[model samples]
Structure formats: C-alpha cells, structure tokens
Target: MRKSVLLFVTFVLFGLLSSAQQTKISEFDLYGCWVLENKKRPSTNIVTYKLCENVAHEDVKFGSKISLLAFNESEHESTGPLACFTTFTEKGTWEFDENSRIASLYSGHEWLKEFKQLDPDEYASWGSPEKFDKLKFRVISIENNQLTVEIIPKQYGKKRTEDSLE
Candidate 1:
C-alpha cells in the first residue's frame, strides 16, 4: 500500500509540471508597427483608416496605443491629409485559445464589445456600429526602413435600387 501511494503522488506531480510547462504568448509577438494598404468606402462617403504602434499582452490585461489615419474623397479629386490620429488606450482582459489559435478582446468594466482573431496575424477591428464589419491586414515583406502591410476590405454592403413599374 505504501509503494502504491508513492507512485500515485509521483504521477500527479509530473502531470502538474507538464501542464505548467505549456507555451505562452509573449509580448514581442504583438509588438510592431503595422500599416494599411487597401480599403473600401461607403456610398455616402469614402472613409479609410490606418494604424501603427506597439501592443502589450499581459496575463489578463491587454493594452495598446495606436495611431489612426483617415482619408476622405471630395468632389471629383482625392483630398490631401483627411488624416487625424488618436491613441486607442484599451484596458481589458484577454485570452488565447491555442487549439483554435484565437485571441479574444474583453473589457470587464464598460460597454465595449468582443473581438475575435480572424487569422494568425490578422486582428478583427470591431469598430463603431456604423463602420464596416472587418478589415483584413497582412504583414508583407519588410525591407530597408519600410514595413509593408496589406489591408484588404472584406465588408462592403449592398446597394439599393429604385424599381419602376410602368
């Protein structure tokens, strides 16, 4: 009976150690400067956004200060610098599911919403309710002093039509 108890205890300790040794995501994996490459606008107005900066991913606390640059089209010509940037200070809880490789965005204290990971290197920006559904950004080749990022528009709504019965 003594030998059997000793063996059981050893097995439990080994199991706990193995579970604790699992890999965890590091801060550097999300730290970088990202840029925009493409976009789609609404009918009423053409709106585009760009982003840049470092993101922090702690145990349960996630935060990032990013710059947003926007562009607008006017008349029949493209306008210059319709751009204004503001830092998004996000303080929330985060969880990463290794099996599905998804990351969840959560704000425990506020009226914010949840965001899911669309791709390995792409993050779904759950913008204002009036904004588009998703913005797909992929990190392209980094050369010289430039980091190229490709932004593909994936959510453009349908248009309305006028029906005439004569």
Candidate 2:
C-alpha cells in the first residue's frame, strides 16, 4: 500500500509539472523581437497587416509595450516619402500565455514623441474603435522564424489587459 501511494503521488506531481510547463510561455522564448503579421479588427473582415512591420520586445526593464512596430506604408498603398519607412510602436507592457500562445500588448496608453517613428494613426485599423483596450494576438504558427498571429477582437468589458485574457 505504501509503494502504491508513493507511485500515485509521483505521477500526480509529474502531471502537475508537465501541465505547468505547458501553461505559461517563457519570456526567454520571446526575448528578442517579433513583428506584426496580421491584425483583424473588431468588426470586419478587413484585415490590417504589415509587410515588414517589426515589434522589438526588449527586456521588461525598459517599460511595458515599448516594443517597436515599423510598418511599411507601401503595403497599405499609402506610400509616400514619410510613409514608406514609418513605424508605430506600443507604449505599454506585454504579456504572453504559452499554453494559449496569445500575446497581449497594452498599447494606446501613452502618446509617443519620436519624430522619426510614425504615430498610432498608422495602426488605426488594427484595434477596435474604443480608445481604451489591449491588443490580443493568438499565435497561428511559428515556422522559418516567422510568427503569424491573429488579432482577437475585444468584447464588452474586455477593455485593457485583464487576468481573464482568453
């Protein structure tokens, strides 16, 4: 009976550890930078994407949502001298769930002041009409160093990044 109990406990512990590993995504795996591949708005099939947009997620030391997103205007057909290499960056923090492979960026929190960096207007089509909300992205697939994520629309009471970020 003792041996049987011990074996059952070991199995339970191992299962818990395995589930924990699958639950949370490590910051190290996302230490570098990731760009936006696709962004579907709140209520429309009109997907907003970037050709060469990049999101530089540095160590959390700098700040939250400090990741930079450089959007190529040519993809939107609004190309111009100042629009070609413009970039829109997040101004808050980043939280990721490994089990769900969802990355939520709390942007639109603060205003940006970089002259070279494009304003959030470039990403006007990304999020919902509400001014206060977080950007939720679920990883579709990761292959060949390319991470494709789908922008999840925010529902009622989903404003800002919450603990129930599903």
lDDT of 1 by residue, 54-124 (tens): 22222111112222212211011111345343224433333333443332333322232232322322333
lDDT of 1 at 49: 24
TM-score, candidate 1, is 0.24
Judge candidate 1 against the unseen true structure and give its global Cα lDDT, from 0 to 1: 0.34
lDDT of 2 by residue, 26-49 (tens): 444444444333333346422222
Where model 2 places Cα greater than 4 Å from the true spot, the runs are 1-25, 36-88, 108-131, 157-166
Q: Please, what is the TM-score per model? A: 0.24, 0.37
Steric clash pairs (candidate 1): none
Instruction: Give the root-mean-square deviation of each candidate in angstroms.
Output: 18.0, 11.6
